[model samples]
Target: MAKKVVTIKNLEYEYPDGTSALKGINLDIFEGESVALIGLNGAGKSTLLLHLNGILQSDEGDVEVLGMKVAENIREIRGKVGVVFQDPDDQLFMPTVFDDVAFGPINMGFSEEKVKEKVRMALERVNMSGHEKRAPHHMSLGEKKRVSIATVLSMEPEILILDEPTSNVDPRARRNLIELLNGLDITKIMATHDLELVSETCDRAIVMFEGKIAANGDVEEVLTDSKLLESHGLEAPVLVRLFRDVMNREYIPIRLEDVIEKPNKYKI
Candidate 1:
């Protein structure tokens, strides 16, 4: 049987001024599943990601990540849930890339030697090797993004949570980021506005609208539902819409590899 990684029930949040952010969100994320959280701005996607890592305490409801409740075990939960914030500038605060990537592991009290090793591995994993000596401000947007992921990866968390992983990246960099995410075998939940990235990197998707979950299902189902996507200020990818024109709805493929590997060839 599959292990239940995170369970959220009646999850709710509000700002100090009583502005509601998340409203009674209920979700279950299984181990090793790659899921996408899609929503328009002010839809509470970032707010929800903060809650998963215990960075933001909610006004109501319970959140359990990796079998541990977030509120009571915040310290432990933060160590297990690695959150990569939307803005690389906000996330990578250390002057040097090495310091930023080593912060998390060091915070967990890893020995200097072990932390060094971990940071090296993390940067290599994100293909940001040899950037350790560079200043965060000196790197390009794409380079900064990878370094930010390295920061979280060095901690070796069980669940990986990211907000707007591709927000300001160029087309080539965006594709590279998607490929890097696809290669990771960890349990990942990404909060993104890029439907194409979601379609390519995630198997399941959850849509948030105005502090509530709008829809949740297989990537293809949620992404291809023209009315649903339109309602949430989104549209299906070009590949998705093109495939839908010819393929049976029951077998709408989401991954690029699926379309390329299949024997039945239809030019889109």
Candidate 2:
């Protein structure tokens, strides 16, 4: 079995204004598992994600990442769990792409030579090589997103957390991002509404509803259940819904490649 990378038990959190963001959330994320946290706008997906790396601490419950308590070892845990926020601007504050990517390693006390090597490798991983000196502010949204991911990659985190990674990017950029994420080998917790990206990258699906976990299972099973998805203010991927509604097919196809492999098998 895969070793558990993160564990949350009876976790609950509330904002200063008495807004309950997470309630009784229990989750276990294993090493190397790409899990998608899916929910509506206020379903508390982001709230739960914040607890994973100690950004938000629950008063009533506990959270542990990489075998250390988030509350006590937050400084250490933050280095292990790299988070890329929804907006690239939130993550890319350094002047240039190289600076932004090197910040994480530098903060970890890496030597100048090591930091430079890390930045180069991370940029290459995200296919943003040769843009080191470019200012992030001048880059397009897609480019900014890639650089944002590279910043986290420089940390060489054991777990990668991304919030709405595909949001606001063009189709080609989205596709490339999906491919890039798929190539990475790490535990990933992605909170996103993009079912297409979820299907492409995650093997497990976690659906949150009103500050609690409504459903958790294999990506295909949870995403293919139109009733469960609709009840949670979500809809299945377009291809999955089409197979169910129009073709009246019993099995839902989540990826384009699956449909293309045997189009006649799904004939209406």
Candidate 3:
């Protein structure tokens, strides 16, 4: 059986102003799973993510990372779960890419030589090799996003958490980012409105609505449910809509490759 890297049970949280963000949430994320948290604005997706690494303490329940309680093992948990924020600029504050990537390892007490090696491997994983000296502020948005990922990668976390990872990138950048995400083997959890990205890279889909889990199932099953998606302010992927609505076919294709594999099967 796969290991459960993250486990949340009856989780609840409220903002300082008494705005409830998460309510009675329960979830288990297993090792090597790529899960997508999909929800409309104010639906508690980000709030739930904050609890994963101890960024926010739960008000009413338990959150465990790799068998340790988040509330009591914050420092240790932080080292194993890396979070990449929605905005790359929020993560890349150092003057150069090298500094940003090396910050985590340096703080973790790695030697200078080890930090350099970590930074190099992390950057290479993100395809950002040989640009260490470049200032983050001067790089393109896509490059900055890669650097932001490298910052967390340098830590060698067991799980990777991302928020709106493809939020502001162009088509080429988005494609590259998708490829990079698919290549990673660690457990991943991402909160994103990009259904297309979910269709391509995620194994499971979780729909969050009003601080509760509305749906949790395989990516294809969840994405094919147009009514379920529509009720929660989400739309099915373009291919799903095309095959189910326009083409009037009962079979839904969530990814482009599905259609490409059997064009005649989906023909009108």
Using TM-score, give the best candidate's number: 3
Per-residue CA lDDT of candidate 2, range 206-243, in tens? 99999999999999999898899999889888888788
Query: How high is the lDDT of residue 12 in model 1?
Result: 86
The number of clashing residue pairs in model 2 is 0
Of 2 and 3, the candidate ahead on TM-score is 3
**169 Cα displacement, candidate 1 (Å):** 0.3
Model 1, span 1-268: residue lDDT tens: 7899999999989898989999999999999999999989999998988888888987589899988888899889888889888889999888899999999888889999999999999999999888888999988899888888889889988899999999989998898898889888899999999998998899899999999999999887898798899889988887777667655444566667777797365443
RMSD of 3: 1.0
Per-residue lDDT of candidate 3, residues 64-83 (tens digit)? 99999999999999999999
User: lDDT rank, highest first?
Assistant: 3, 2, 1
Which whole-number lDDT from 0 to 100 does residue 188 have in model 2?
A: 90
lDDT of 3: 0.94
- Candidates in order: C-alpha RMSD to true structure: 2.0, 1.3, 1.0
Off by over 4 Å in 1: 245-252, 263-268
* Clashing residue pairs, backbone N/CA/C < 3 A, model 2: none
Backbone clashes in each candidate structure, one number apiece?
0, 0, 0
Candidate 3's C-alpha runs over 4 A off are 264-268
